[model samples]
Target: MIGDIHGCAKALRSMIQELAPTKEDELIFLGDYVDRGPDSRDVVEQLIDLQSVCKVIPLRGNHEWMLQSVVSRGMDDSMWLRSGGRATVTSYGGSVRKIPEEHMAFFESLLACYQTESEIFVHAMYDPSCEVATQDDELTYWTHLPPSLPAPHHSGKRVFVGHTPQPDGEVLRQSHLVCMDTYCFGGGYLSAMDLETETVLQVDRHGHVRRVPVERFAMLLKGCVHWFRSRDS
Candidate 1:
């Protein structure tokens, strides 16, 4: 599974090349695929191409939700642009007048959440009190994980999320929940984790691979808590 891409197409391509995944290796993307970086257009294009050959599970992040609202509900672009939609607009030849039909379809088709017997993948936090089937957009896309969350959700499935950036540029794990968004658009790395093996591979914006002890990822909750507090303060 990979983290929030945020339009870092080069880093995304680099990670995909390094993984060299076959059809049997399902790629679950944790969302925020567009906005904030230079090539939202090309990023989504590559993802669409990858989908034709490999199994890909794409979730809806808050950014995608904003775009979807603007396009489908006739919401204004000001909010989206304020939140980095300008880069996305620029990606499509400096116009927010229209986005390709295919890209709109891609955004519309994204799931709120996906799950297996042992784990759940969401773009953001999930309400532990509700069944995964009953989760809504507020919980699935807009909510960031609080630093106080120290354990897995009540369902016991390992929950994986994105949206919140990790200051240390590492995958943050707390009990059974993990956050993989390392803020690739903010000069951080794009992270991909192999669930079956618990291995993580990261690629920076320049396409350089970065290796860190996988064990350290399991202890990232401390760093995450610190970062969260600092940001909020």
Candidate 2:
């Protein structure tokens, strides 16, 4: 699974090359493919092209929701424009109208969440009280993970999400949830994780690559638990 791209095409390109995934690999992107960086246009184009190389599942982020509201529903774009939409417009040659038909279709087709037997993927937080299928848009695409860990989802499947940027370039890992947004557009890394092996690969816009070892569960949980207890006290 991959974290939010946020228009950092350079980092995205670098990470793809580093992964060197084949047709046998399935890539899940936790969206925000546009806005706030140098090349939202190229980022979307690359994602579309990736379909030919692997099975790509893209989720809708709040940024995508905002863009869709403007381009598809013909709503006021002023809010989106102020919130990094201008960068997206500039990436598309200074107008949203220049965004291609195929790209529009891609945006329209993005999923709110995807689930497998043991894992659930969404762009943002999920309601632990509800099933993944029943999650509302606010929970699926807008809400950030709280400072303290949330209750585990009722399904017993691990939940993976992006949207809450980790400025320190670390994956926010807990027993039940993992947040991969490393804030690439803001000079952090673009992060990807291998679920089976628990390996994390991070790439920067300058094409630097790094591998982060997954922390031992006991140690990770111990520290987090301590923090939570202290916060409550």
Report how far off residue 121 is in candidate 2 (Å): 0.4
lDDT of each: 0.87, 0.90
Q: Tally clashing residue pairs in candidate 2.
A: 0
- Give the Å shift of residue 183 in candidate 1: 1.1
Residue range with the least summed lDDT across 10 consecutive positions in model 2: 209-218
TM-score of each: 0.88, 0.89
Which residue pairs clash in candidate 1? none
Over 1-233, each residue of candidate 1 has an lDDT whose tens digit, in order, gives 99999999999899889998788779999999989988999899999999977899998889999988887898988989999998999998887556889988898899888999999999988777787668777878788878787355788999999998998898897668899999888988899989987788989887788865545665697789889999999
With candidate 2 superimposed using the best TM-score fit, by how many Å does residue 159's alpha carbon deviate from the native? Answer: 0.5
Model 1 spans with C-alpha error above 4 angstroms: 212-233
Please write out the lDDT profile of model 2 over residues 50-127, one tens digit for every residue.
999999999999999999999989989998988899999999999889999999999999998999999999998988
Supply candidate 2's per-residue lDDT for 206: 66
